[model samples]
Target: MTTPTLSRRLVAEGLGTLLLVATVVGSGIMADRLSADTAVSLLGNTLPTGAILVVLITILGPVSGAHFNPAVTLVFWIRRDLASREAFAYVAAQIAGGLAGTVLAHAMFELPLVQASQTVRSGAGQWLAEVVATFGLLAAILGGLKHARQAVPWLVGLYITAAYWFTASTSFANPAVAIARAASDTFAGIRPLDVPAFVLCQAGGAVLALAVMSWLLGDALRDPEVA
Candidate 1:
């Protein structure tokens, strides 16, 4: 197979992230409108976000590896699978596209285009949640690439779906997505002030996962009997 141009890969990353964030923000708006119950709204938001992830990753994976998440890109960059320059571009594209996603979602819902989230997602538990969420996300990607390349979409989608419930901050694992979400005042939004810490925790988590996966998935350990 031929290598896709950097331009093409960038487009895929942006478009996929746009769609992913749109689903996240739009579904949050819809869910909030439909129910007053937090659990019900969360469930409504979770399913579409998870479903769109699977769809976007499947369709766009071949084009850009469908990173759509800066944390994921950061991991690949750290691993040297992606160049520093390309990684920077990928992150820029993902952030821009994710912001556009919030715009699109708001426009579709007839809400204001620009917003600042009032939802206060902070504190130690929230920070820890981000770390855990990002770590799990990286683990899923690395493990999937190692053993089940074709199933990566499902792996990511299901992981996020589960993480949204299990994690305290509802698993905003992507720094780009976290930034975009800070622009929204909807259910899925996080306060702008909260973004930096979440991003930092996410980065830390990605790096830690990289360290662990490197040792775990390498030629370090294998069971001949199991094989």
Candidate 2:
């Protein structure tokens, strides 16, 4: 099989992020419209997001490691699995794709194309939730890839699904996603003012995961499986 070029990998990252965010934002919109109960709406939002994540990661993993998240790409860069320049490119693509996805979701639902979120996701509890959520997400990816590469997709999907329920902030766990979500005013939205805290917590979580995984898994951090 021919190895994919850098351009191809970049495209995969962008496209995967686009679809992932679309699933998240679009499902949230639909769920909010369909259910009066907040819990029911959340359940409606969670399932499709998880399922689509599994599909996207499974299909795009080989192409670009299926990062679709700036935090994940930053982790790989820290581990030296990806070069700095490439990592930056991946992050940029993810952010752009995420914005596009949020816009697309609004357009599809006939909502305004752009609107700042009024949904305030703040407080110490929510920040802690983001930290824990992101830590678990990275841990699942690294551990699954180390022990069972084939299971990484499902592991990630399930983790996010559960995290949605357990975490106060519903596990945004991703900087790019958080930024994009600030533009949305629906169920999945987070106020633009709240994004910095969430992103900071996410970054901290990624660092924690990298350190813990490096210690616990030892050489697995450097294993080709991660690549």
Candidate 3:
């Protein structure tokens, strides 16, 4: 297999991050304006987030590999799907794109430069919830690519959607995403101070998933049983 270039991967990562954050921040502004004050309006935001995620993965999966999340990139690196250099580049691009997206969202909403969203996520249960949610997410991404290559992006989208509602943390499984959300201060954003806890849980969860996936898929990876 021919290796993808760093320049190419960086471009894909930038585009993916831009799209992800735009959809999130834009939908958030729209939802708040439309719903005013009601749980029913929240779907207006979440629906778009899921849609963008699926679209980016499908469009960019081959090029930048559609990591979109630092955790996802880290998992791939662990699994050898990505090189260390490539992984670091992708992560940097993700962070830059995320910050750009947040700034754009702030501009669109006419919010202050430093203004932040009010969304709250915390507690041990929530932290553990993030772990489970991220583990499932990483597992889905890794397993799909390894065993069920055809259904990769679609299945990942479904996993995120489900994890959002099922877990107490609502599946903000990506640190780049978590950081971007904090900027918008939308329904999706967590506070800057709260970020460490969420990121820590996410990282722990991803590491755990990596361990388990390796054990189960190691033999398959070594042998290439899929025909």
Candidate 4:
């Protein structure tokens, strides 16, 4: 099969991000509306997000590497798997797509088009959780791609599902996702003021993962067989 053009890749990235964020935000809204219990609501939100991720990654990976997360794109750029200019373009697409996703969710739910989140997700513990969550996410992606490319989608989906319950921040490892979520006021939303810290911790976590993985895997880190 012929490789897709850069424009096609960009479209895939943007579309994937849009769908991912829609899954996250829309599921959150649905969960809240359906359940009075917080745990049940969380469970409802987690499953669809994870499952959709598996589907999206599997379908879009060949086209754009399925990097819905800006953090992942940045990591790939640092590892020289992606060019700097392309990385920037990918990030812009992700952020724009993410915001569009929130808008779409709002439209579906009959909520305001854009509302800053009031949900406070702050504190040192939350920051640490973001770091750990992002670190683990990148590690899973890299390790799975290296050793079992066929399982990368399932590995990522399961990891994020678990991270949602384990982490204080519910594992918003993607900067674009975090930023878009701050525009929402639903169950998955984070305070707008808290977005910068989450983004920083995510970036830090991604960098640390790349460094350690590079050390552990050596040249294998340069080009893992991703699926």
In candidate 1, what are the lDDT values of residues 15-76, reduced to their tens digit? Answer: 99999999999999999999999999999999999999999989888878899989988888
Per-residue alpha-carbon lDDT of candidate 3 for residues 31-130, written as tens digits (9 for 90 to 100): 8788867564566766787778888888887777788888887776776767688779888999888878888877777876455767777899889998
User: Better model by lDDT, 1 or 2?
Assistant: 2
Local distance difference test, per candidate? 0.90, 0.91, 0.78, 0.91
What is residue 198's positional error in candidate 1, in angstroms? 0.3
> lDDT, candidate 4, residue 127?
98
lDDT of 4 by residue, 1-227 (tens): 67777798889989999999999999999999999999999999999999999999999998888999989998998888887898899899999999999999999999999999999999999999999999999999888878888898999999999999999888999999999999999999999999999999999999999888878877676662243
User: Which pairs clash in model 4?
Assistant: none
Model 1, which residues run further than 4 Å from truth?
A: 219-227
Which regions of candidate 3 deviate over 4 angstroms?
A: 221-227
Give lDDT tens digits, candidate 2, residues 38-133: 999999999998999999999998878899999999898888888888899999999999999999999999999999999999999999999999
Give me the displacement of residue 50 in model 3, in angstroms: 1.2
Q: What is the lDDT of residue 215 in candidate 2?
A: 89
Query: Candidate 1: deviation at residue 23, Å?
Result: 0.2
Off by over 4 Å in 2: 223-227
RMSD from true fold, candidate 2: 1.3
